[model samples]
Target: MKSLCRIGHSLHSRGLTFGSSGNISVRLPEGGWIVTPTNVAMGDLDPSQLSLLDDDGKWIDGPKPTKETFLHAAMYGARRDAGAVVHLHSTHSVAVSVLEDIDPADVLPAITAYYVMKVGALRLIPYFPPGDPALGEAVAGFADKHHALLLANHGPVVAGADLRSAQYAAEELEETAKLFLLLQGHKIRPLTASQAAALKQ
Candidate 1:
């Protein structure tokens, strides 16, 4: 819980999230997860008020889980290795999502080795209203093969082996998105498929 609070504070302070616009969750060792509560500012998450869900995703205690709980559950259900998930309405990421002609299979190019390593391939989930079950299903459809996804006109969803990993990957994604936009209209050289594959291995 303290860890979640710390990361939440860091994300909020850094402007990664604003006005209760992001969500995070970490799987519990015993079972289920500790999730940020609904409609609460990430800057002010109380440890005791964090939502707790049992293994089946039933709310066991604390405040209500983020309405996007289905998003987290979908990731966990698809990827057994995903220990944490982070979803954010970050500026750059959301900007990229709305851009036309971006590939849905893998949105961003491998701009940096760190980007390739931390957030390998990013799939684009089609637009769906917030809290829509179809959105969750769309995420699940790609979660097994992808640790990261960008929702159309929404933002990014990233899963990692642990909370910090998820957080760092999410930050890396935002930074890469910023770089992608900055380098537009330039003759840029993103890593080739072979190079990116090597980093993944």
Candidate 2:
């Protein structure tokens, strides 16, 4: 959580997120995980304010786990390759959530080879209330197929090889979301399935 606290503060300071609108977690080197607490100001989150939880969502120690513990737990469960989770209420990415027709199967276009190789397919999960278990379940359901997902009318959650990778992926998600919005009114000549597949390889 100390790590997330620092990252959250940095993100907030840089205007990537604000208030208590985002949460981050990292699997500890030894075991367990450290996560940000719910509704706490990112700028004020000290190590003391963070939560440590076991893989099963059990509080192993430290402050109470974030209300979104289940969501992080589900990520850890579904993606054994994941060592960290980052959920952010970034401005542009959340903006992508309100569109009525965002495709869940392959929401993000391979507008660039970098997006294709780094993020693969970005999915859009349906709207679930804040702290809802169904949100976790939905993410878990698509874990194997995506590295990043846009939560409807909410934000984005990304799971990656490590905390650094998760953070990078979250930033990439926001950047792509902004691109997606900018190109909204235009005809997009995005990469086709075959181009995406070839680039991914």
TM-score of each: 0.98, 0.92
Colliding pairs, model 1: none
Best by lDDT: 1
* Residue 68 lDDT, candidate 1, scale 0-100: 92
* Clash count in backbone of candidate 1: 0
Choose the strongest candidate by TM-score: 1
Give a tens-digit lDDT track for model 1, residues 28-116: 88889989999999999888889998866778899888999989999999999999999999999999999998999989999999999
- Give the CA lDDT, 0 to 100, for residue 100 in model 1: 96
Global CA lDDT of candidate 2, please? 0.83
Per-residue lDDT of 1-201 in model 2, one digit per residue for the tens? 457778878888888878877888888877788888777867778887788887677887777767888878888888888899988889998998887787777777778777776678888889999888989899899887787888888888889998888988888778888898999889999888999889867
RMSD of each: 0.8, 1.6
Off by over 4 Å in 1: none
